[model samples]
Target chain A: MDRTIRVLVGKPGLDGHDRGAKVIARSFRDAGMEVIYSGLHRTPEELARMAVEEDVDVVACSILSGAHNTLLPRVVECLKKEKGTEELDVLVLAGGIIPAEDVEFLKANGVDEVFGPGTNTQDIVEYTKTNLKR
Target chain B: MFSGYPGGMVLYLHNQIIQGLCERKRAGLARAVTLVENGSEHARHILEEAYRLRGHSKVIGITGSPGVGKSTLVDSLIGAIRERGDSVGVIAVDPSSPFTGGAILGDRVRVRSRTTDNEVFFRSLASRGYLGGLSRHTGDIITLFDAFGFDYVLVETVGTGQSEVDIMRYAHSVLVVMAPGLGDDIQAIKAGILEIGDVFCVNKADHPDADRAVAVLEAMLGLNRQWQWKPPVVKTVASQGKGVVELLGKIDEHLEFLKQNGLLEERVSRSYIAALEDNIRRDTVDRILTEARLDGTLDLVLTQLSQGKTYPAAVAKQLIGKYLCAEESDNQ
Candidate 1:
């Protein structure tokens, strides 16, 4: 059986701007991956809990509220702290109005990749396919 | 601990998962559900254990058309159930793309109010080409939840049309949610849906036509129906969590009706029958197709089909005879 890569597309924090998240979710679906979308205003704890419960291979955080500096790393930290998720090999990705300089910091803080504005949806899909830890 | 293990290592992980389940760990239940959803080789062992530990939970099926607030209603219902001191497990199903076998499961978005609560566990599923607005392994996952010791297991189906009455086979009480102004009056007259609903909910009651929708559903339900526990229609603004308590009350009343009349056992038996049929199809039809694909028999059949040399019915008969009857004869 072909393993279907499951992704948790989360918009953590008070950002109601989920257009980018929805677009990426559609792209992932079109690429034959299952996307579990966590709707707007989700806390990092909720995202991590959902990722663990859903057993997803990727945790894609879409932050348009410019809180990525604080929120994105907390998502990774919460996932690590979530019960039974310590062993889960999740590829964490961050996207949305992030500055280029902060991309390195995000990656160093457990985000595997950071997609800035104008990043193609297909690139995210291919990146997910290539970078999946499983 | 569940995936990518080899040989005996897989068995060890299965045992570990089972132990975790026995200890009532949330992670164990979550991983077990994933294993069942994936149809892993270890699923049978887990399901066997789950079946042995079943019968503690009430399975409620919530289904309706798209945008009828099924997920929102489920989220509210979860609150109601929790307020009554019952732990609930929610399995929300969404349709997968037929072209790509992928899906966007957005139900969890609406049903995320209880994320911090340990007693509330929500999992989203893709229909995965299974028609009838549900995943193929939905029943098995419900079993896992029941075994995990939840007091209630709520199943939210993919937005369904008229023919998706499959939810009735698994649920003790089927809640058919409808929003106002969806032309649901005419929908109420649809045969398959009207007959299967144990309780009907007209959601988005703040809409001007909410009363009309409820009246239409009641009037349609009253048409020539016998007095054996008539299905009640409740109105609710699910987004605001209004009228949810009444809706849950009506559902509980229906459950009481099922219990008093001994119909709950019938529903249980129906679910078992459905499970048996599903497993038989997996063992027979799925196994046959997989083997045929592996041995190039499917390629030959497709060639014959495209050339108009053999019809589908004839090919099906030949394959069944060769694969099934031949095995029977050999056994004899």
Candidate 2:
């Protein structure tokens, strides 16, 4: 098997609903991967540090408070600030109730994919694998 | 000189207890979790041992709007799991007092009567303005519980904001709670929430217009046809324990479906990577704030932006300095 992939999952800002994030985290655990969940209300700076310290391969963020347009990019910016874009080896993904148009915008800004409402667990798993494999 | 043999024996005994915890020994699990929460030296040793067994349990988070009765649903499921002879662990993420930073944890308080049950290991965490409806040490705590051998671990959060969504990133499955008469606007207002839920619960189904609300949600789901698992709609009167059994079944089915498709491994890998990055970012910030003392510069920048002397983006550009990616890419 390849090295155990690590991830830093966080809820940034004031949004408190974590049911979705927790479920995803558990799913990952059941799949036999290492996951470090930053318990709620994290700043982007804190999240970036978490990614680096944990040596995570990806940073999957779930934002439902509708701050993705602002917060998502800020998270990407924080990660990239240390070095060139190459320093950002971690795949930054977002989930939660994002509008269709906004998803495209976020992807343009740096989000790998924005899984919206009703995206199946299997699809997410497949997408994640395909992306990570690359 | 100290007796090395006795010390070694004591350490051996500690390891045995920790190993027992990882094997799901009830008393051992309790003791180990307490040790970690208390930040005891013994806890550190226990954690170090448990860390080797870390990536096993699936952490499912349940969150929704307040008064949607999320706790009651969790309670019902706990009871259901017990009926099936499975031990269940729960971490209730309660609201923190914005003023005092203490947590109310009303959910745990309501379930106090069940705390004495040998099969149940429950903890209440204070959000403490942690923003994501979880404790800063939540990851460690979850690992502690998992190592302790709880078959199913559930986290219930105060259903609002990015904090609740953050919990999903940590969990294997997410259940979004909603109720009728909350109005169409709430549904629309929280459209982002609708997108994240793997399972949607229209709680308080006994209330008026419940079916209509379900209809509306069904329509919404229909519009979005690109999901991995068709987000199922489960209606319940959580306060009364109605539909609890069906809901539990659905949860199990979802779990099985994920396992069957080999999606479980992929999801876990993504979550692991995400978690690693989050940990790195958090540590880096702590180091900067504590060691570099960048507060002064941050304050200066904020002041400058507020005074209209510079745009926020421009300030960010200056604060980060000239090693912009385009400029630095050539050197690397």
State which candidate has the highest DockQ: 1
Candidate 2, residues A1-134: lDDT per residue as tens digits?
Answer: 12344455667777999888877766655554455576677778666654543445668898899888999988888777632354466788898888998977888887888888788866776676668722
Model 2, span B25-57: residue lDDT tens: 544654455455444556666776676776666
- How well does candidate 1 match the true structure, expressed as C-alpha RMSD? 3.0
lDDT of 1 by residue, B241-269 (tens): 89999999999899999999898999999
- Candidate 2: segments with Cα more than 4 A from true spot: A1-134, B1-20, B23-48, B161-163, B185-190, B294-332
Comparing to the true complex, what docking class would candidate 1 get?
A: medium
True contacts kept of each: 0.72, 0.00
Model 1 bad stretches (over 4 Å) = A84-88, B1-7, B184-186, B294-296, B303-310, B328-332
User: lDDT winner among the candidates?
Assistant: 1
Q: Comparing to the true complex, what docking class would candidate 2 get?
A: incorrect
* Least accurate 10 contiguous residues by lDDT in model 1 chain B: B323-332
**Local distance difference test, each candidate:** 0.87, 0.68
